[model samples]
Structures are given as C-alpha cells and as structure tokens.
Target chain A: MKTICIMCPVGCSLNVYEKNGEVIVEGNSCPRGEAYGKTEFVNPSRVVTTTKRSGAFSYSLKTDKPVPKTMIFKVMEKIKKTPLKELDVGDVFIKNILKTGANIIVTGKLTI
Target chain B: MSSFYDVIVIGGGPSGMQAAIEAKKEGAKVLILECNDSLGGILNQCIHNGFGLRQFKEELTGPEFAYKQYSEVKKLKIPSVFGAYVTKIEGEKITALVRGKEKEYFSKAIVLATGARERTAGEIKLAGDRGAGIYTAGTAQKMINYYGKLSGKRVVILGSGDIGLIMARRMTLEGAKVLKILEIMPSSSGLRRNIRQCVEDFEIPLEFSHTVTRVVGRERVKGVYYAEVDENLKPKLETEKFLECDCLLLSVGLIPENTLLSEVEKNIKKQIIVNEFRQTSIKNLFISGNSLHIHDLADNASEEGAIAGRSAALFARGALEELGEEYEISFSSAISYTVPQRVSGCGSFKIFFRAKQNFLRKKIVVRCEGEEIASKFCVGITSGEMQEIEVESGKVKGPLTVSIE
Candidate 1:
C-alpha cells in the first residue's frame, strides 16, 4: 500500500507492504516516517484536535495522545457530550477518555 | 505611560511577539500594540498540531506554540497593549485608538508585523447572491475551533488550500457532511500531509479541475452549480452539475494587510517590499511576517521577525550602517516572486520563493554576474510549499537570478 507520511510537513511518500512473512517499508526521509508507515500499515491512529464549549466561551482541546482511527467518532461523541466548566489552558477535561489512554486537554485559552 | 520608545512593534501575533522579544533582547525599549485582546492572533483558533517543528524542534499545536512564545514575551517583561487599533503610521509616530480614545506613540524605529487577510467570495468574483452561509476558510475555522459552532450541516469547500482541507475534516468530525472539495487546478495546492490526514483519512471526495460555476441559493446557501474545467480553466457548460450544500467555504488565498503603508509604498501584490534586513525603502521602518510576504510556516515568520527586530533596534540606536549597493533578486518564469525583492551586502542569506509548478529532483540554482553562486538539488518540490535557498554573498555586480532546472 502507498501512503503519505503525516509526521511533518515534509510528507514523505511511503510504500508499506508485507512480503514473505515480513513487513517492509520504503521511501522515508527520516526514521519517524518509517515508524509512521509501519504503524499506519498495522493499526492507524491520530491525535484529534477540536473545541469544547463551556458557557459562552469555547476552548480548543486535543487528545493527549493518538487514538485508534476507527474510534475517532466515538471519541468525538464523548467530547461533545462532556460538560466543561471554567477552565484555563492546559487543563484536562476528560481523563483517559474511552479507555484510549489519551486525556482530552485544553489547548486554547478561555476568553469571556 | 511614556509616549515614546526605542522600538514599537505592531500586531502581536507570532511575528510581532518574536519581534518584540528580539528588540527587548537588544536592550531597546519596545512596545507591542495589538488590535485583539490576546497575543496569539490567528494561532489562537488554529487547534491543529504541526506547528513549532522548525522553531522548537518538537511538534506542537498552534495554541501550545503560541503560549510558549507568549510566556517568553511575559518573561522578558515586554509591555504590550491589547485592544489597541493602530490607525496611522507617519514616519516613526504611530496613532492608535485604545479603549475608544486616540493615543499617540513615538519610536525611533517601527516593525510592521501586521498579518494577512483571506480572500473573500467577492474577491474571487463568485457568481452568487449575498448569502449568509458563505464564509472564508479562516472565518469558518474561527467559528468552529473558537466558537465551537458548526457553520452548516452540509458543506462544500472551494479551493484545495490547507485551510479548506483542514476544515473538511473538522466539519466532518463535528457531524457535518462535507459533500466535496472542488479544486480549480489539476492537483491539490495544499500540503500532501494535509491531503492524506485531513481529506483522504475521512474518505472525502476531492475533485480536481472542478469548480463552482455559480452559487444557487438565496439568503442562505442551498446548493451550488459546479462543472469541470478545461485546460484554460473555462468551465464546460455540458459538464455542469448541481450539488446540494448548505454552506460554501472559500480557501482561495491571502493578501498581505499593509494598509498603513499605503502612503509609504505600494505593491500590486499587496506585499511590502523589503531588503535583507527587513527594512523598507523608508529608513528605520521594518516589515516582517505576512505583511512583507506570506510565509508557509509560523517558524519562518518568527525568524524573519527576529531579523527585523534586530535591525529595527540597531536603526533605533543609530548604529545601523548601509550595506553597500542593492541588487534586485530576479527569478525565471518557472519561479514565483522571491521575498527580500532586493539583496544588499550579505555574507550568506536565505531567499524564500515558490515554484510555479511541481518538480521532482530538480536543481535550484542561484547565479550572480553569470557565476553560479549556489545550487542545491531538491526532492519532490511542490508549489504548495515555500522553498528557501541560501546564497553566499559576493561582490555582486549584476542582478542575482534564481532558476530551477
């Protein structure tokens, strides 16, 4: 399978395939790209970034770590239903959300 | 408050904050004036990760990168006034309205870090009635990421810029059905990583060589008439089709906001022309960041701001010296405009530009006086991303021309 590495803006085109009981990855400029190719070929995950509303203010939040790609909408559904209170930037809104081992933390400031 | 300073930086975005930090490091009294109440500017609403890679050597989200810089400015004790709308810039004097009252400030040197604005629907001359559901990509981003409000239930994005692609995913994640992304060009103009992670990840349809010929709605967008275009970018009447979309988002392009410098200088591209030091034609007036030229990354803007800040401080201290004769940096037709339109006395300086088209394993060569000064082989260079090349300055006798082969 051919895919583009999203590790950075470089976006190295990577070729990931299984051959003879071994997985092979090629066309990466860096080791991170190679890792991304391998992981993506196996089980894909992504760090989701979005906003959560509390009162009249909205604060940008993101998963503290990458979660399984298949469970993205489920995580988003949890984020939408989760009620947020007065919080500052860097504050955690949800802990280990959906057993994904990723906490939802605020990335934006709360402006009234 | 003292009405005078050694240096005054306008716009407290990433570039403005970096400029203020660098100026303060030079032991110059610097003040930052921001129109918004916060310092982050657009980075506040950009919740995505991928920033701070070049600057901090770590992948950080926009807000994370912004807060890091803002903390530095705070640590330096650089005084900044938010909600200060600058009205005029006459020489080294700046007039702004702070809390509805006009205030004047004087400085020996000034750095204009005012950023860029998005191209609107009217700017692109979209055939549409005055609608309520149309928004620029940045505006939609601000609404979704800042206000946590979805713009529409069904979205149709025009132009394949990075913002449009990011919004496509954001809207989808928010439960909005992004019908499709239409690009007038034959290929996507956004970064390949964005195309992979944002659009392709969600299985969103991206149609190239297609564009909305007319907007079909009143009061609020209900749908749009789109068609495939030929090589000349002319829409084929026979290929016209309609798509049901409640909202249309445009991610066309950005124009540098240099309205304050209208009396000082003018460029058809709306970008401020500056030298290697980021100094404009007017002495002691420096410009950086998007006001000078659109930068693909915030890290480059901060780097440019640092140069401009240092130069502004030196100019304020009356220690800046002339750097010999200036030579225009020319480029071939295959290349787009080069920043620092002119170069003056440099040991080794970087020139940033964009290619007109995609090229793989091409050589970017810089020549001065018919002598090849520098050349580097680039891999998979695309017009979507900006490219920078370093040139070792010699006693330049003629125009420096940069070409790709």
Candidate 2:
C-alpha cells in the first residue's frame, strides 16, 4: 500500500507492506515517518484538537495523546455533550475520555 | 500615557511577542501595543496541531505553541498594553487610541510585525449578492473554534489554502457537511501533509482548475455556480454547474498589513522591502514576520522577528553602523520573489523565495556578476512552500540573481 506520511509538514510518500508478519516501510526520510506509516497502515490514530465553551467564553482543547482515527467523531460528540466551566490553561477537562487513554487538556489561556 | 522607550513593537502576535522578548533581552526598554484584548493573536483560534515543530522540536497545537511564547514574554517581564489600536506612525512617534483616548509614544527604534490580513470576497471580484453565509476562511475558523458556533450546515469552500483545507476537516468533525472544495489553480496551494490528513483522510472532494463563477443566493448562501478554468484561468461558461451549499468559505491569498508605512516606504508585491538585518530603507525602522511577506510557518516568522528585534535594539543603542554599499537581489521569472530585496555587507546570509511553479529534482542557483555563489539541489519544490538558500557574500560586487534550473 502507498500512503503519505502525515507526521509533519514535510510530507513523505511511503510504501508499506507486511512480510512474514512484520511491517516494512520504504521512501521515508526519517524514522518518525516509518513509525507513522506502520501505525497508519495498521491502526490509524490522531490527536483531536477542538474548543470547549464555558459561559460566554471558549477554550481551545486537545487530546493529550493520539486517539484511534475511527473514534475521532465519537470524541468530538463527547466533547460537545460535556459542559465545561472556566478552566485555566493546561487544565485537563476530561481524563481518559472514552477509555482512549487520552486526557483533554485546555491549550488556550483565559487571561494574560 | 505618553512615554518614550528604546524600542516599540507593534501587533503582539507570535512574531510581535518574540520581537519584544528579544528586544528586552538586548537590554532595551520595549513596549508592545496590541489591538486585541489578549495576546497570541490568530494562534488562539487555531486549535490544530502541527505547530512548533521547528521552534520547540515537538508537535503542538496552535494555542499550545502560542501559550509557550506568551509564557516566555511573561518571564522576560516584557511590558505590553492591550486594546491599544495604533492609528498613525510618524518618524519615531506613534499615536494610538487606547480605551477611547488618544495616546502617544516615542521610541528610538521600532519593529513592525503587524502581520497580514486575508484577501476578502470583494478582492476576488466574486459575482454574488452581499450575503451572510460568505466568509473568509480565517473568520469562519475564528467563529467556530473561538466562539464554538457552527458557520453552516453545508459548505462549499473556494481556494485550497491551508486554512481552508483545515476548516474543511474542522467543519466536518463538527458535523457540518462539506460538499466540496474548488480551486482555481491547477494544484492546491496548501501543504502536502494537510492535503493528506485533512482532505484525503476525510474523503472530501477536491477539484483543481475549478472556481465559483457566481453565487446563487440573496439572503444567505444557497448554492454556487462553478466551472472549470483554462490555462489562462478563464472559467468556461458552458461548463458551469451549481452545487447546493448553505455556506461558501473563501481561502484566498493574504496581503501584508503595512498601512502605516504605505506612504513612507515603497513596496514590492505589497511587502515592505527590507535588508538582511530586517531593516527598511528608513533608518532605525525594522520590519519582520508576515508584514514583510506571507510566511508559510509561524516558526519562520519568529526567526525573522528575532533578527528585527536585535537590529532595532542595536539601532536604539547607537551601536549599529551605517551601510557602506548595498547590492540588489533579483530573481528569474521562474521564481516568485525574494525577501531582503537587497543585501549589504553579507557574510553567508540566507535568502528565502518561492517557485513560480512545481519542479522535481531541480537545482536552485544564486549568482553574483555571472559567478555562482550558492547552489542547492531540491528533490521536489512547489509554489505553495517557501524555499531558502545560503550565499557567501565575500566577492559580491554586483546584483545577485537567483534562478531554478
């Protein structure tokens, strides 16, 4: 299978295949790209970044770790349903959200 | 309050904050004038990851990247005034409207990091009624990410800029149906990673060499008439087709916000001409970041801000020397434009530029008086991303020309 590595802005085209139950990735310029290709080909995941609103204000939030790609929309639904109050930057809004082992932390500062 | 300082940095965004931090480190009394009530500028609304890859050596969301810079500004004790809208700049003096009262500030040197503004729907001459659903990609990103308000239920995005591509995925994740993305150019202007992760991952339909010919709604955006374009970018009337969409987001180009210096200095491609030190033609004045030119990455802007900040501090301290001779930097038609339109007393300086089109396995050569001073081999280059090369300035006696072969 041919895929583009989304590890960074320097997108590298990768050729991934499994041989003898071991995954092999080619055409990657870096090790991170190889890992990304393997993981993407096996079970894709991504860090979900969005906003959570409190009263009259919104705070940017992101998953502390990458979640399964198939579960991204599910995470968004969970975030939308959860009502959040005033939170400081770096505060975790939800821990182990949906058993994904990723905590939703606030990234935007409320006040300077 | 009216006061005099050694350096005054405008904007207080990613670039502005870095400039102020560097200026303060140089032992100069610096003040930052920000129009927004808070710091971080546009980065606050950009909640996506992929930022800080070069600066912090780690992938972080836009807000997280901004928070790190804001934390540095706080640690440096850089004094900044929010809600200060600078109205005019005359020589070393600046007049701003602060809390509805006129305020004045005088500085020995100034750094202009006002950044860039999105090209609007009117600039593109879109034949449409003045409707409510039409919005620039940045505005829509702000509304949805910062205000938590969905822009529309169905959308048709025009232009494949990175912001537009990102928004397509954002709106889709928020449960809005992104109908399609239309691009006038033959290829997308956004990054390859974005095209892969944002559009292709979500299976969004992206059509190149296509554009919206006319808008089809009066009150709100009901749909749009689109068609394919030829080599000359002319839409074919016969090929026009309508797509039903409640919202139309435009991801067009950006223009530098250089209104204050519009009359003072001549501009090329709507960008203030600066030297290697990020100094403008006017002495004691430095420009950096997007206001100098649209940068693809915030990391590059922060690097330019550091140079401008250090230069402004040196000028304020009366340590900067006068230029003896300067050489003009020119580029071939195959290339777009080069930053630092001119250079003086160069000793291995980097020149950033973009290609006019895509090329594979090409050589970028910089020549001075027919002598090759620098060259680099690129595996693949595109007009969407900026490229840079280093040139040694020991024997440069005439104009330097950059070309791709």
Candidate 3:
C-alpha cells in the first residue's frame, strides 16, 4: 500500500497489493494508474467541492459523480444543511447527496 | 468607434486565452481583451481535477481546462471583448474601459497576458491588529472555490504556497480548522504533488523554517503569532508561537500584473522582460503568461500563449524577422531565472527554468562561448519544477550559459 496518484499531474507512485479480493498494481504510469489502484483498493470515490449557504453569499457545488470514500463527512453534512437561495450553473442541488448516489451540481454561475 | 486589430490579447486569462487563440491561428485579426464577465480566466475558480495533464491529455477541470479554450474561442468566432477595461497604453494604442464608455483599440502586436497578483496581507509585512479575518490565497480561493463560503472556523494558513497547500485541503473540505502551514522557506514553494496531495494527504502541520510573525485579530480573526525562522530568515526570538485562529490564509507570493508595459524593462521580479518570441523588449510588445514568468503550468501558460500568438502573427503580417545576434543567456547558481532572458538568433527555442536547489542527480550544463554546448541528466531537480531545454539556431552564437552541476 504505497499510494500517490491524486489522479494526475503525474503523481504516479502507486504500489498496492491485496490478493484474494484481487488488486496488485505497482508504480503505475497510466491505465489511470490501474483505475486509481482499483478504486484506491475497493472504494475511494471523491469529486467533491463545496459552498452551499445562500442569501449574502455561497455558491459552488459539485458531485455529479465520484462520492463514496465513506461519503466525505456525510457529504459535508449534506452540503452544510443545503441553503442555496439560487442555483444555475447546472442546477441539480442534490438529487442524492449523502445516499452517495451523487448528483449535487451548480458548479458556478450564481446571482443572489 | 475604433477596433481595428491584428492582435491585441490583454488578459482573457490562460494567457489571454492563449494569446487570442494563437493570434487567430496565424491568419491574424484576433482581439480578446476580457476584464472578466466570463471567458474562463482563473479557470472559473479552478475546481481541482489536475487540469489538462499536458495540454488536454485528459484530467481536466479548471472549468474543464477553461472550457477547452473557451470552446476554441467560440468555434473560431474569436473576436472577444467582455468588459474590456484597459485604460491606457499608448504605443500601439489601447485606451479601453469598454462597457462604460471610453474606447480606442488598434493593434499590430500586443499580448501582455496581465495575470499574476496575490501577495497582500500588507504584502507579507503583516504585523497585525487590522480587523476582518484576512485573506488572499486567491481570495480564499474565490471565497471557497467560487462562493461556497465557509471561510473560517479556525483556518490560519499563511503560505506553504500552492495556494497555501490547496487551501489546506480546501479549508479541510469545508469544515475549516486547518491550523498550521507557515513555511518561511527551507523547502516547499509548493508542488511536490502539492506537498504530497495538499499537505501530506491532510495530516496538515507543514511548518518549515516557519513565519507569520504576528497577526492577531481585532474584529474577526482572534489569534496567529508564529516564529522560528533563522538561517537568515530571521525571527527566532525564543521561538514564538500563538495560534488560536479565526482565518488568515495569505499564501504569500506572485507579482507581475504587467500594467501594459510602462516604458518596458523589469526583472527584479516585476517580470515583463521577455525575448525569444514572447517578445517584449519593446518590438511590438509581447509578454505572455503570469505576465512573463511565474508560470508553473496552465500548460506553461498555454505554451506562452502559443508563442505570443505566433509572435503576434508575425507582427501583424509585416513578416516579423529581425534577430541575428542578441545572445547572452547565462545561468548557474543552480538556475532560477531564465524565461527567454535573451537569445535571439530566432529559430529553435525552448529554455524555461527553475531550480535554485533540490537536485539529486544533476548535470544540466549547456554553455556556449565557454564551449560545452548542451547537456542534461537531471533527476528530482525541483524548485517547484519548471525545467525545459532546447536550443538551436546556430547553437547560440554569442553569450550563453546555464549550469546545474
């Protein structure tokens, strides 16, 4: 279990070893580092991003995909109790936030 | 009512949208302008995801690497303006202030990708007492990656660079509490995979030589003192320490905001010096990317905005040639400043640099008048990585150097 592929910028350096449930990987230079070492050895998930509060400010969001890693602090506490006075850059708001089915959206463009 | 152009970039970001899409793919007509009101810059709040690996080899994000060059400048419609805001330049004319009146335009060759800026916290003079939670790690990464705003719960970053280690894991994934980072230099001007995935996979703590020297709060923050420098960095006074924190980001350095050339000449870190096609030593004023240095990728500032949009499309069709002697490259002392620092015989080029320390295999070499031409061997070089090499055009005629040993 070495780890390093934070997905890109050639972070490389993987090395893992699991056997039985299966996983071998080693110093990967691509194959997306063997699917990021078999999903960081079974279930890493990530694509998070934050900011939800509304009224005076708070906009960014993201999660249309990659979620699990034990649901990043229960999806940042369900996007900090989801308070978004207005959404637009791809809306969605949270069709499945912590259930980890993903779908959070609004990756920019707000007006309130 | 004036607009005529041949090239006229001026900050649309990602090196003025890759120097107006490489000077409109060389046919030249180009425009760009952009003072923000859209058109990607700062890749719309840079949402993580490694960014176009090596110019679109996958791993995208930073607004899908700036919406794939703003959808190729809107499918080749090019001609941009977006809130303009120039306000004066003189030589090849420029004026600006577009949307609220004033205008002027003209162009023949002008790029100046006005980028870099972020030092504030009283430009690292920080003593303290002034109120409101302090910021400038790209304004707390645009107030939390484009307004998601959690801003502070405990924060206290202060610069290990790489946007204070990616905002100490984006303010600890929006929960806040970062606590330590410091770095008065001893290493980590960032990127070792951003100090290993944003501060050693979130264990945080960083430290290094240390710094921050006082910043308590008066209205919003509440504590943050710091110390432990030495080795010429000063501040050791019995190793101070304070830390209660409310928020204080400040990821230290970055300069070159290239205020439209200003009688040219700069490089005591105000950058704007250029040569070898990124031009600006006057001749139609080019200057690209982090205002001409400070480029650690955004695809090397879109390959120096496609070589200053093909040398401003051969200086707007006059065929741009002139360059035979002008050598003098020089370096050594492990190299730290060398972006076309002067090398015109004009043909083959490349020379990017960075590495004033952190070598593990060494050799780099290069030279010319002193003889030994080209050499390389490098390994783990680092100085926050940039390194590039390539030199031809009669293997540098006059003064050249560059060493690593």
Question: DockQ: which candidate is best?
Answer: 1
On a 0 to 1 TM-score scale, where does candidate 2 land against the true structure? 0.97
Candidate 3's displacement at residue A12, Å, is 2.8
Off by over 4 Å in 1: B266-270, B393-398
lDDT per residue as tens, model 2, B1-405: 448999999988888888888999999999999998888888888899999998999998888888899999999888889899999888899999999999999999999999999999899999977667999999999888877788999999999999999999999999999999999998998998899889998999999999999998899888999999999999999999999889999999889888878554565456677888888988878888998899998888888888899889988998777756888899999998998888884555789999999899999998988998889999998888999998775856778999999
Q: Give the higher-lDDT candidate: 1 or 3.
A: 1
How many clashes in each candidate? 0, 0, 2
Assess each prediction's global lDDT (C-alpha) against the native: 0.89, 0.89, 0.77
DockQ of each: 0.79, 0.69, 0.14
TM-score for chain A in each prediction: 0.91, 0.92, 0.36
Candidate 3 per-residue C-alpha lDDT over A54-106 given as tens digits, one digit per residue, 9 for 90 to 100: 77544566787777666777787877776665666667987987566778877
Q: What is the lDDT of residue B49 in candidate 3?
A: 62
Among incorrect, acceptable, medium and high, the docking class of model 2 is: medium
The TM-score obtained by model 1 is 0.97
Error in Å for residue B137 of model 1? 1.2
Alpha-carbon shift of residue B330 in model 3 (angstroms): 13
lDDT of 1 by residue, B23-61 (tens): 999999999999988898788888899899899999889
